[model samples]
Structures are given as C-alpha cells and as structure tokens.
Target chain A: MTRNVSICAMAQIKNQPAIWQHRFQGMLMECFESIMEQTQVTFDMDTGLRNVVTCSDDVFDARTISDAAVTDVVGAHFRGEEKVAQDGISALGYAMACILSGHDDLILVMGHCKESQSESRNMCTNLSFDPFYSRPLGLDYLNAAAFQARAYMEETGLTDAHLADIVVRSRQNGAHTRHARENEQVTAKEVMASPLVADPIRQMHHYPVTDWAVGFLLCCEERAHEFTDNPVRLTGFGSCMDSYFLGDRDLTAHFALKKACARAYTMAGITDPEKELDLVELNDACAYQLPLWAEGIGITGKARGPKWMEAGGMDKHHVNLSGGMLNGNPLMLGGLARAAYGFTQLQGTAGINQVTGLQRALAHGTTGAAGQHHAVLILEK
Target chain B: MTEKTTAGLVADIFATMESRVIPEGVDGITANYGYIITGPGGGQWTVCVADGRVTVVEDLVTPDVTTTCANDDWIAITLGKLDGMTAFSSGKLKVTGDMGLLVAAAGFFEKYQPPLAEITVADIFATMESRVNPDGVQGITANCGYRITGDNGGEWTVCVADGKVTVLAGIKDPDVTTTCADTDWIAITLGKLDGMTAFSSGKLKVTGNLDILSTAARFFKKYSPPSAGPEEAPEELIVLKQVLSIPQTFATGPVMGHFLNALKEKRILANQCPECQRLQIPPREVCAECVVRCKEFVQIGPEGIISTPDVAYYASPDPLTGETRETPYCSCHFLLDGCKDHETMWHELKASDIPRAERGVRVRPVWNDTLTGSVTDIKYFEIIDD
Candidate 1:
C-alpha cells in the first residue's frame, strides 16, 4: 500500500489588503515559526524535515526565482527545496508526494503572496495570457471572469439577485473565520448597488486583493502522531488543466473542475460526494463560481444551480463555511486557504463555523482565467 | 446597395430575437410581446417567449404587452440610434397593457446588430462637403488634393474658400496633395488612425505647401461610420494604479567579485576546480560538477571563438531598467582561449557582427572607454578579420 500523508499542523498570518509594513519574507517567517512551535518539528535528516516545498509566483513578487527570497526562513538552506509556482495547495500535494515516495518522512510546505506589492493585481494576472492574441485585448482575471459569469448566467438563469445573496452570505461567514480578511458585513441591497468592475461582475462579487503567508507540517501517516494529537488525513489530491484559450471552452460547462473532482473522488473511494461529504470549501474567486463549481463537484446536479440555491442547498451542504475565497484571499493561495480552513474544521477548532460531526471535507483551488485549471483535495479527520 | 424598407427592417429585428434573448431575463416566464408599426411599410408582429424558448409570428396574437410606434421610429430604437424612453416621452411610441412587463422586457434582449454597411474611402470623400465645419474655414482658402491608391482608390480635390467648401473629382491645381493607401485614408478620415502618426510612419505622404495640411483636422466634423452602433461607456471603478519599486543591494561573493574586478584592467579570469580540473568563467564559489569550493584563479583570453549564437528577435524588458532591449541582437557563448567544451562564457555578440556569428568564428571583446568593474566593461564581442 502507498504511504498515506497527513497534515499535522497548519499556521497562517491574518489575511489583509496590503500588509505594507512587512516584506514577504517577514510574513513567511511568522508562519514558519508558528508551524515549528505548534508541531515542535525539526530538520532531522534521518527522519524529520528533509525537504521543503514552497509556493509563490514570480510575476506577483516582481522577481525571478522568488522562492530564493524565502529559502532561509523555511529552513531550506543547503537542503532540498522545490517550488510550485501555481497555487499554494499544490505545494501541499507535492510535499505529500515526497513523503509517499519514501524520499522523506516529513516535509515543510510554505506559501506566500503579497498581492499589494504589485501595482495592479489584474496587471500581473494579465501577463498570464499570450502576448499576441489575448494580451492586446487587455484580458485579465477579472474581465475574463466577467465573460464566464455572463455566459454561465445565460445558461443557468442565475440572476443578479442570486449573486448579491452570495456576497452577503460570504461576509456573514467571514465574521466567523479566523485569519480571513476582516471585511465589513454587507447586505444584499448594498451588494446589488455596488458598481460594476466588469459587467455582470460587480466589484462586490469578486474577492479583494489580499496578502498572506501560510505554512503546513505534513508527515507520513504512521509518524503523524509525533507532531500533533489532532491530524487531518489528506486522503486524496487531484488537479486538471483545460484549454488555454477562453474561446476554446464552454464557459458554463465546468469541464476542468469536474475532471479534477472526479479524480479526487475516485482516489479517495468516494462513491457519492453529496451524501458522503459533510463540508466543502470551494475556491470561489467570484460569486457565480460558487454554484458553478458546486455543480462541477457533483455535490449538486448539473444545470440545477438556480434550483439548488432556491432550495437552500448552500446551507444544507455546509459549503464555504469559512467564507470561501470570495471573502478575500490572495491569488495563488486560495486553495491553501481552503485547506487551512479544512484543517481547522477537522481539528474541531473552527470556533463558530465548525460543524457537529464533520467527518469528511472537500477543499478546492483553481488557477488561470475563468477556472481553466482546478485542484481538489479530500481531507478526513 | 438598396435601401431597406421599414417592414423589412422590422422583420429582420424579429428574425434575430432568438439569438439575442437573455435567458436570465425571461426565466420561467410566459409572455407575448406585440409590435404594431404605423407608417409606410408598417406591419404587425408578435414575439412569444415561453418554456425558455422564443418564436416570432407575422400577425399579432393575444399579447401581455403591445408597443405601438411608427415604422421608422421602431427601426431607430432597434438600431440603438434612438432611446426608447425618449421616443415614448415625445409621443412617438405608445405602450398598452402590462407596464411592468415592458420595463422587464428592456433587459430581455442584447443590443441588436444591424447588418454591416462597410465605409469606403469614396464614401468619406463624398460626405466631406456636408460634414465641413463653418467656423473652421471662416478665413481659410486652400486647395487640397488626395491621391488614394489600392483597392477602391481614386483622386479627389477639396477647395475650401473662405467658409465655403466644394469637392471636385480628380486633382485640380492643388496647393498640397496627400498620398495614401485607400484603407489607410479611410482609417485616418474616420479617426481610427491618426493622420500625424500615419505621416510620420510613412503610411501617408504629404508634398507641397506642408503648412496647409496642418489645418486639415479642423476642416471637417467627426465622421460617423454608417450602421455603427454607439460606443458604450466603460465600467466605472475607483481603481488605484501605482508603480511600486524597491531598491535592492546584491552582495557578490569573493569569487564573483574577483572575476568582475579583473574586467576593469582589460583582463579575463576563470576559476579552476581542484577536483575536476575544469574552469568556471565568471566564477562561482563552488564547482557545480564536483560540489567543492575552488580557490584557484587562472588568466584567460580577452579574445575567444564563438561556440553558439542565438539571435533574439523578441524584445523582453531588462529587469534593472524596465525598458525593452533592442531586438535582433545576438546572444552568444564564447569559448575563450584555454577553455574547452561547454565552459564557454555567455555574453552578447556585436550587432554589426551578428551576420558573421557562427561556430568557431574568432571574436574579440570591444571594451568601453570608461571601464567600470562590471560585465558591461566588455561591451560585446565582434568578429575579428584575420
């Protein structure tokens, strides 16, 4: 049997708009020390912490080889260190792979993104596109999501009122989530009145730009007891990427998301996700993506998003109880944020957002424009 | 091109109803929208939307809401040339039954696309006289000639004499003549392409009495392309755009510092690994191959043979300056004297020597007049003539 990996401890600084006072290295060091304190882990070559997986993006940091900036803080000096330039959750997945492969027993996964360090978050994301066809059109994550939002709404009859309800509920749930960006509670009316940044995507509908740093202590399942009494077993992990071009995709189809979720489900031996899973955390960068990704995960029937919302499926399924990504988490760290929340809920330390008998949880993360790439992780206590 | 009758225009609007329906606006709704156009070529029609589908009929059916308007006004509203509320307040359009439904119906369709009527250079010249501004030519008298080439191209002259303008076919004793491609001329006249930019870029050429052409912009009002919809205002946001930069200090270790210091005195240096006996140009503290520290330094040549040459055509900005590099410069690796196989030092080959850049070509470093202890001390490598 393949070795099982468990996240023994999770640590993060608070999510904020800028954190202008601290550099990204300073932000990461806090989480690194926190993880070390929480787990009492060490860089023991024989059995403890041999490799580190770091998550960051060069475009956001404005420096090439960004992981080099945080190598010393994460204890990667003169040691094995790898970087996942995608989402932070992928760093966790990579650490899991290293432990499972028997290369190392314990691995440190650290991720940081200072979105405030850049001039415009959209301008940095705009570089993700090819220069010839997409960049000239000024297609960024926001406007590209606008195109998807308009198209998804057309297919599912998702109204503007439905989107407003999502924004209002996210802020309400954000009040209960620790380390979540502290945004003022907004009513549905306020959300509806908010001006559009991109048509069909009101400024209130999308997550705000945020700066954050997170670290996790992941170890082999057999050795996990040494780190913490409460360990969240990461049973399954899967990711999928769709076509690069926006025109090549069916905006409402949720093609990449479905594939990602299916792979995770099969790996975790989850036969019925809607019936088996107790909690879900979706990487909803925008409001419409909540229901769209819900359907993609097979937690709700396809094209039944509007009906599902009307029937209170969001509450029934315990989705995004940590306020989700719409409550403001930085890009490239949304999945890691979801995983952090999942770890909290599993540890029974989620405060007000915790469920009574939370046995299984699904946390998702996405990258690229209009959900072009997706990653799903299944965690169990 | 034949003019479209009002009835045909109304029919075309209904024909495109299915393609333009916003599903969210009509979700779970069953409604019949009727139109009774009154004027020459006026007719009645009905659009039925039910069960998330839409269909159009020639005759009016029992309708939840009926809009009554002249055929021309209906066409104008559909084309977005006239606002529906402005027509309604002016007594040109009347709505009967279900006023609430009419308000909801406003969002049911996307902006309609009238068939494209391409604007040509000939059309721009033909409308120039009608579009002339009286204030612009109040005291100006000049004859401007155009020699438009390429497809749909022709010659024409516009004579502006003291607030009165007349256009004549072909050049006639022109004070200044502008020559350009037909497509470029149309783009310039329609304001899609700036005339000054086109002239500077050689897309447009002006000869004789250059001062007269300076007033050409004031000669006419803005031209509107036929059948073009109004440009929608961009979405508003209080977005903050800032340029954030950090000054950084890089500490070059003793090994790299030694290599750079030698460049100032017109010398080249490479560190040799004790274990592998291999040289590292622009030396690193540790040898990657043997994983050992190197303490030995050897003097190499300021002249070398090009091992590999890569000509870069795409321009990427320099990290330090944030300015794009001039393109088509050759990035090359040179095997300096006393070095063998992949120990080649990387630098740029001179632009003038780019054509001669090839394997085994003998080249020498061209040093800057003021030598700083930097890699740029040797500006670039140029091919040496034996």
Candidate 2:
C-alpha cells in the first residue's frame, strides 16, 4: 500500500498593522475553514485528528514560556499537539514526520511571530557570537554576514552587483506575488545605493521584521486526491541540525544546507537540481545567501562552476519568487511561508505569481545562529 | 559611608519600634525629622515636621529609601491603602540609612494616629512629580490577570499587591515563591530568568519572601533603572559562606567540601562522569546523561577557545552592584583547556584587544587575587597563546 502525500490547501495572514494576539488563533481557524470550503471536504469534528504543530524560540520574544499561548491558539483540544520551539521550517518538517509516523491523515502546521513587541535588533544580536568575544567588537549577524560575503568575494570574485541582481529579481517577483506587501518595489541600482547596514550588504539586502500568520493543510495521497484534481505531492523532504553556536562551523559554507539538499535530492532522485527543479523558494533572508545557496545546492553549472549567476543559469530556475525574507520576513513564519509558496507553484495555483506548467519545486529554510540548521522539501505535480 | 550610619540608625529604629502597639507616654516622644536616603540612582526624600504637624518635603534632595519598584507602588503605600510593613517584609521596599529615624518616624504614625483624609493621591503624585501613566502595565489589573494553564490543562490566576503574591482560587499552590532584594526582583522581572546568573553573580538574595520568590516572576513594563557613575572595579576577593544543601540531588560525600576548597585556590574544577567521561562544570552531583553520582574531581585549566561570542552595544546598570557593566563586553563560551570533548564553560570575556579575538581564538584564565571556591574566582577570560 504505497501512499502519496501532498499539500491540499494553504492560507497566509500577513497584515502590516496587526498585533500578535489579534492574528494568532483566528487567523489559523479562518484558514482552516477556508481550506475546507475551497477543497469541499469535511474535517473530523470530534478527535481534532488533524495534527497541529507550532515553531518558535524563547529568546526571540518576551513570551519566554509561550507554549501555553500556542497550545491555546492552535486548538489542540483532544489532539496530539506538539511544538518545535526551534524555527518555522523545522515545524513543517515535524508535521511531515507526523504524517510519516502514520498517526494522522491531515496535518495543519502554523507559525506566528510579532517581533514588534520587543527590542528585536538587540535580541537578534544577542543570538550572535559569544557576548564576551564577538559582541564587544560589535559583531552581530549583519557584521558576520559581511565577513562571509567579503570572504566569498575574495575567494570567488563575486561582485556586489551580483548580489544586487538577486535583490532586484526577488523584489520584482515579489511585486507580482500576493504574499508581498503592496507598493513594495525595488531596483538593482537602488539596492546598490542602499545604506550599508554591514559593508557589502546594504540595508536593502536584509529582511525587515514583518507580522504574519501562515498555515498549510497537508494530507496523505488518498486524502489529497479526494480534495483536489491537481494535488501537489511532497516527493521528498530532508533536514539537518548544526551547532547551536555559530563559531563551531565554517561561515563560508552552509554544510547543513548542503547535507539537507543532498538528502532531498537523493529521495527525489534529482541528479541535477539546476535542471530537474522547475523553481526554488530558498531561504534568502539576506541577498548574499542566494549565490551561496545556489553553489551549495549543486545548482551551479559544471563548466562555469562558481559563476552560475553570470551564465544566466538562474533565469531558468525561479528563486524566491515571493520576494523572500528580504521583501517581507515574518520571523517564525517566513520559512514555512517559503515552503507554502513552492507548494502553490507546483500545484499551478500561485495566482498572481503563478509560473505556468510548474512540475517540481524546491523549498528551503535555514534556522538558528547564522543558518546553522537547514531544511529542504521537494514538491512534484 | 556617612549615609551608611544614618541607614544603620533607621534599621535599628525600625527593628525595635512598636509596630502595632503604642505606649501611653509616647506622645511627647513623637517628633518628625527630615530624612534623605539615596541608593544607586539620585534617589532623595525630605520629611518635614513642626509642633505635631508632620509635612514630608516635596523637593528631591536625596531619597530616604530609593527602591527599584514602580513609583506608583510607593505612592500607593503613602496614600495608606498599601501597607508599608508588608512591602518591606516582601523585599519590595529597600532601606539604606537612618533606620533609627525611619523607625521613630514610623512610630510617630502608630502613636498619634493620622486622619485618613489628610493624605491624598494628588499630594503623593505632586511630590513624586509624575502622574499614573498605565501604558503597558498589563496582566495585573482587573481585566487582565496572570493567566497560567497547567500541564494537565488546568487554568490558574495570580495577583500581586503590596509586594505579596497570591495565587487565585482554583489555581494550584505554587512550588516556591522567594523574597529577594528589590534589585533582584527587577532583574528577574526584566526577563533575566537565568537562576545561575541571579545567584552566582550576586545579583539576587533570598529571605522571607521565598515562596513568592520562586514562582512570582518579576514582569516589567519598559522600566529602565537609573545609570551608575563610574567607580574603580572591586579587587577580586573570595568570600566563603556556609555550605547549604545542594539542590536536586542529595548525595552525601566530601565532593562538596573538595569543590569548595578548590575555589579557595582559584582553580576551576569539574566533576568527571566515570562512566561517560563527561566533564560537569560547576561540579554537579548527578551526571546529565547517566543520572548517576559523579564522584571524581577533575582539575581543568582556565584556558580554551572562544566557542561563541556576542557583542553588546547597550548597557543596563546592575541595580545591586550600583555600577554599570561596561558596554560591549564579550560574552563568550570558553572550552576549558583540559576538559573532555564537548565540555565548555560560559563566562564574560574581558574586552581587551577584542578585534583580534574571533571564534577559534584561544583564551586563558585570569584568576582573582583572592581565591575562594566560588565561581567568580576565575574573574574573566583573556586571549591566550595557541
């Protein structure tokens, strides 16, 4: 009995002027109802059998003991509810694990964040290198990224213009995407001229903290078939955790991401990711991550190798078609939203940002201090 | 030190004064004297009196007792609804000098009962020069109470007043509520829940408010403590206190004595798990993996590589120390030189030549001149030769 798994429906609630408490529970419930109505399927009312999971970290917000609030808003009443307490993409991977465990059929995974409630910038820096060693030197995530970017440029001769192109293209795609905020547009020249937040990486290169609530309804193959005619199957999934502290790993390379991508490609029988995948919704929280991730995931051409972007190879592969974190990052929900965007693309229902005849798409998420943990999921039509 | 003498007198007076009962011949002895108590911040108070007419000064010269609690709480007590004795007993109110004067003045209130109508909220507000502004103070009022959902799906409510914490009906009795210094309460309230930091760093102390201390966390609403003036850093000295019972595990042995003695020598030591060979820093009674007693003591050197480092560009003055921690101190994880694999100690790295210090940079131990077995004996780490 070979069962297939697919994304049946998805919903996202991203409001510019919304508080955390306002959007948490109602947004999830509304998404649940909308998915049911759109798919024309009735969910179990008694058991609440649809497994639910939430992802967040204590250090990220004032709600240090936030699991209580999560359990309440997630409606875990009489259900096997769980919290990842890590990052958003890790929660998605956990939801998929629940399906693999054969415990439930339909699974709803949600991630919500409100960085506006606290001093986010300082807190973000607190998660950087050791306070005694790196902090006194004013070394934050921005500075660390600059170090890695400078190292990459020195080693690979990649220019800041290449990084600007990534921002320009991502924002251009975001302009057409529903997930993007209205009236948000940018150009390569503007991205280049943007104030240097951490030399080589300008202000436009990073994602601003946005408020969002995103949910996805995943089902087993039989159940997915009952909901929609063009069900997008989750062909493969992989994830890896690196050291919690960033100094333990090399900053120049994303080993965890590479390992995760290898696992996903092996599961999906993807020999050449650059050609096999129709689109990619990679974790481009910063602009530099694009080229670095492209090289790491074996998306680089064999002949040109490091100069994949120069060859116009990325034109065929749509990366961060939903503006990415650079456009509108919702902290805990950003990674899951990236996966949802990829799933929509594979289903041929991305709406305004739809890519025609999309068969296979890759979604990736990076978590913890400096992308220490990586998660990759492959979806096929 | 001059303020210390006045603070001592106040403490003595309060300790000996008749709290609830007044003697018949106490009328002539009841006299009001001006008081100016100051702590870290420029906290000052002036109490004025003439011929049975008691008038507290409005201008802030130096506070008689400047505490870390919300000014509204202070006003509430002055208005008579909130009991001052209860606040002091709960560790919310801190007094520094003129204990005798405070006790005598407090005694005057007991001896000659003041009319309730004389003291008003407006008077207290005028003195404090601030009106009640409830912008982000939530969860304590009638509409918003402390909501706690238990592990078994039970709901609980908590109420805090006059420095006392009470669990509402239907809520299970809390495990522990500790009464500590007001500065400690403020630190814990401001989301610094690291118990080790509070205890080992001497930022907190516990007394009668034990039950409230353990459970009733200090939740703050954007309250920043007053800045501290620069002063010479105290020379390293080890102060030995009586060994209290180790928490969690009750293993009886000389391991505790040995660890304490090691601190006296300014040596960083850890208990090695015989079975797993894991080095447990701050020597624990039980190993985290095997859950068995760690009997062997391993002397680890004070140097290692910087595992992780974070730069702090902001400063929050430590209330208890009455000094501001230098901004941009390196908070790094040092893997002790002689420890087994994956064993590291966390400490603040001295910010000298920080530009050269990176993730894999080796660091050496900088011991205090005074050696005691306490954790602070190691002072702060400095960059070392590989």
Candidate 3:
C-alpha cells in the first residue's frame, strides 16, 4: 500500500528560440510530448486517464484563448479538464484537489507563459481591482510593489542592500542550472547600479520575462510504483487567499503565506520547518518578498540562514537553488517551475545545483496583485 | 519668408480677413483660421482652423454658434471613448465639431491620442453586462422615481423615462424625497454606494423616497455602462466552436499531438488516469483524485452514460461555423466507459435523443470511421441500451 511517486520524469523548456515562430499551443504540445516520451509512458486511447490542469491568464497574448488551447495541447480530448483562472500555483492546487476527491489517480499540472509576445509590465492592469479607482490612477504592479517594499523597509528597517544581495545570490545560483537563461546572471553591485523601476525597487530586483513551461505528474500510491522506482510522496500541501484588495492587508506581512505554511507544516507532521526541510523553493518574483515571506513562513533566525548574501550565514535549508523567478519568470510557469525545482533537489536530479543529502523540501508559489494568494507543497523522498 | 516663418505669419491672417473684413464672401476667399475662448475657472479653449465660421460661444457678443456640455462629461467623453463621432452619436456628448474649421482641426488633434489604447468591443460588452442587470435577475427592471432637494431648499423630481434620466415636475405626493448633502447626490450619481450604504447604516437621514432609494440599486444597470463594442467577440467562443466543428479522427502517435491534429478531422478521444485506474475517454496529464501523473494512454470505445443534459430553447448563430442550428439541440456530458469514473466530456446530442437523454442513460460514441484521434471522431453519442 506504500505508493511511490518519484519525480519520475521532469522537463522544462525555457527561452526556446522555436517559440518565436510556432503558435504557443504547438509549443506546449511539443513540451508535453517531450516530457511523456522522456518518462516513457504508454499511450492508451481509451481508459486510464485523469484530469489535466493548465495555468494561464487571458492577458498573456501567446494563446489568446489559453484555456481551450491548453486543453487541446494537453490532450484533454474527452476527459475532465480545467484551467486555473489565477496564476500557475493555483492550477497545482486544482490538481491536488482532484487527487483528494477520489475522482482520478493521476494528474498533470502544467503552466507556461511567453512574456516576449506581450507587454509584461502592462499585465498588472488585469489583476483584480476596482476599475474605476485603482486602474485610472496609473497604478501598476511595479509601483504597487514599490509602495509595499517601501512600507516593509520602513517597518523592518531592511535596506536596498538586502534586496541587492538576494538578486546576486539567486542569479549566481541560476547560472548553475542546466536550463538557465543565457546572460541572466548579475552581481550585487550591478543589481544596485541598475535603473530604478519604482522607488525602493531596482530593475534587477524584479524577475525577468523569459518564455518557459514547467509540468509535473502526480499519482496515487497504487499507481505511483508504476512510474518510478523511488517515489517522492506529497507529504502535505496547503494554500490560502488573503484579502483581494491590496489596501486591506498589512504590506509587511503575507498573512496567506503564514496560514499556508502552518497548514502545510501541520499536515506534514513537522514541528519546525527549518529543522525538517532540507531545501526550500520560494516564489521570489521580487527580491524584497524573500525576507518578508521568510519571516511570514517562520523560517527566520539562525537555524536556517537567510538566502541573501547580506545575512552572512549559510544554513542547511537551501533556498531558490534553481534561481527562483528572478532569473527566468514565465509568469504562469514560475510557480510550477519552483515546485519542480524543489522536486528535482529531492529526487537528486538537480545536476550542478543539487544539495547534499536532501530528503525533504518545501515548494511555495504565490499569485494575485501583491502576493495575496499563496500555495505551499511539502515533498519528501 | 521661409515656409515655417510664412506659416507663423499666417496666424494673424484671420484678423486681416475680418478687418475688411476681407470683402464679405468674395469668391475664392482664402484665409488662415484660429480661435480662443475662455470658460469658468479660467479654462481656455484654443484651436487653429483653415476655413469656415469659428463659433466660440452662443453669447451675442461672442460668435455665431456655441454648443456646450458639462465640462467633466466633455472631458471624459473626449478622453475615454473613440472621440467626437461616438460622443455625438451617444447624445451624452455635444460639440461644435460640425463647424468647418473645427471639423478640419480634428485631424490636427489626432496626434494627441489617449495614453491607453481603446478597449475592444467584446470587453466593453462584457463590462456593460457585468455592471448592468444580467438577464436572470428579477425585479431589476422595475420603474423607479426619486426627488432631490438642492442646497437652497428648492426641490425637483426626477423621472427615469425609458432608460434616459430626465427632470420631472414636482408632485405634492412624492414617491421618495430625502434631503441630503449635494456631495452625497454627486456620489450616488457617480455609482458610489458608500453614502447610501451609510444612509442604510443610519448615518444619513432619509424620509419619503425610501423605495426610490432602494430602486436606485439598479442604477449601475440603468446607465449605458462602458462597453467593448459589438465588433469584438470573445476569443474563447471562436476557439471552442472551431474545435467542435472538426470531426473526430483516430490517428495516433503522441496522444495529445494526435488529438490536436485530429481537431482538423473532428475526432475526440479519451485517456485514462493511471492513479485512479479509471478510463479517461479523453487523455489528460493528471487524475483529479490522486494528483498523480497519468502517463499511460488507453483508447477506450467511444461511449458511456449521459451525466447531464441541457436543452437549449434558442439557437444563436455559431460565429465560427457561421451556421444557425435548429432550436433545442441538446448539450450532454458523456462519461466514456473505462475512463475515470464520473468524468465525462461535453458534446451535442440530437433532438430525437432529448427525450431519452436523461442522466444515467447509456450512450455510445458513434465514430466517423475515418479514425482520427479528435473529439469529433465520434459525432454525437447516441442513447443505447445497456
């Protein structure tokens, strides 16, 4: 009865040149086929399938009708399929819901985005807001983050150096990943010298728009053995949504992350995430979110040092080892890529960036106007 | 003079024409044109026109013709919509753009476009639909009345005729008239419910017009809210119809790849979830229940039970195929056998099967026999005995 679902097979296509010409749907199908082939799964036209969840938004121009395009790409021909209306992390949550519902055994979660095809900065206007008020004021995601980052700095006395350090370390680590985007790496001084997008947030502090697709395969214990010799069990998973309006919540604290982390820890039977988890993959779309979310997740202090170089501490819990979103953010794909990166570390397939003796890892994903929605997954080998 | 200096020198040409004032309506009259007008709060309106009468305002001392709209409305209508043409057509707008010089100057101002691009027609339609009373809401269209007392205690009754708002004569017996600050009235008209919510919260005083106030809940629906025009269609509808039209085919190498290509042939196929061990008629990446990866694909016979049946009483023209179907075409959920239990794919069923297509009825996928792995492969599934 012990089911083993390893990271049996995982693949990511990032910043590929072919995406420039081919339709995004075609690119997605190619990615899915490559993953399936690499995993060596037999194709049965009739039975033995579950659900497919796609992560995308209407704003992304690559596939104007992303949901239908994804359904067609993922082969949800006559099967149950759904698209997460929010970011990619929410799609992973939908897949998890299907698993817990006793409906299907295997689930495929995929998310991808091509920022080059659309105005990435303008995508912020699409986030849920009172159209009459916020949108008319010329407010956008960067400016909103600037307001929050300034608030956090004011509240905690954290400096721009802290953020710069994060960008430096993440880019350096990203340089080691096999699929790292070329010329994406940058140094702390270079990050600091970069032009300011908004007050308190430099251009280098934000994640870049790189075309990417990340997919994961999940299964029940019964069929888990069929896929991989060593399965990585989904020890626990939790997600929560905070107040939809940015003005309603405290900027310094991610209340959703705290609640999500608590539920995940409780389900995974871990008293201390710092002690139990060997590696951590946090969604750091902006560098300032790193320390704030760390504090929110209760991973602060010496047991596990901060991921930034300014902290001057190297603790056991390796964070953002795959460079997180800073190096290559494929919008919908960033969250799944974070989760897959965590899984790769746990499965010992994290080529150059692999952490030694990594057993348990924490994968976190966030969405919404100001990280208002959060999802935490605990994967243990 | 050089062309640039000559153009600058022509600025006073209108004054020169009027001083003759240029031999009143002489044939082939030629003169440069421009105008300057002042408004409340020292607002200045200045423009340059090549020819024709330039009416500044209606005042006898001013110009031949002057048109006016609420300044804020004028600004919003100009900056927000597609401009003067739409503004004038909507009647929320009025302009002297009809004047010859003003009409010609419209081209000069074209370079000063708004920062944001115009919203698509479909988006505007969606905005209007969401803000307006949707089709199903009851009591949303009832007639309502309201009375407002101005600051000097002068009162006026407002009647909503058809959907356009208009001032009505005062009635001794009022429907609902509550005295409130002009700010609150402005807020109410602007669609802010904070003042009203506070009124209901017992902060602001209200009296005779309580029903009218309640009816104002439909105000968002009353005004023609901003909308994307009819020209833009929802992209999803177009894609969905395209996928539905193609007949299903059964050719297969990579299941998903084959399925996408099969759309051109109109065939639909199902893949099973390996975790739940159910036959998923259409293949997918994961099972809904276990969150496990479904890598194995099995081709099940096109068939199963009708999980749900929705009969359409009206048939709108399908934009993609550009065809109008007969009314009462049935959309049903067909749960293919051997796929995940309770999982079904949606498809159209014929009118003849409507009576028999109750939930739980057995249905078999009637394939097109061409064998392309597309959803349309089996046209509509027919009711079959177990």
TM-score of chain B of each: 0.40, 0.34, 0.31
Worst 10 residues of 1 chain B by lDDT: B240-249
lDDT of 2 at A14: 56
**Comparing candidate 1 with candidate 2, which one achieves the higher lDDT?**
1
For candidate 2, the per-residue lDDT at A317 reads 75
lDDT scores of the candidates, listed in order: 0.87, 0.61, 0.60
If you assessed candidate 2 against the hidden native complex, which CAPRI class would it receive? incorrect
| TM-score of each model, paired residue for residue | 0.53, 0.50, 0.51
How do the residues A84-132 of candidate 3 rate in per-residue lDDT, one tens digit apiece?
8666766766666676666667777767666666544454344345565
RMSD of 2: 32.4
The A-chain TM-scores of all the candidates are 0.99, 0.89, 0.91
Give residue A181's error in model 1 in angstroms: 0.5
Residue pairs with clashing backbones, model 1:
none
Q: Which candidate leads the pack in lDDT?
A: 1
On DockQ, the stronger of 2 and 3 is 3
Ranked by TM-score, the better of candidates 1 and 2 is 1
Docking class of 3: incorrect
Model 3 shows how many backbone clashes? 88
Off by over 4 Å in 2: A15-23, A26-29, A39-50, A128-139, A301-306, B1-386
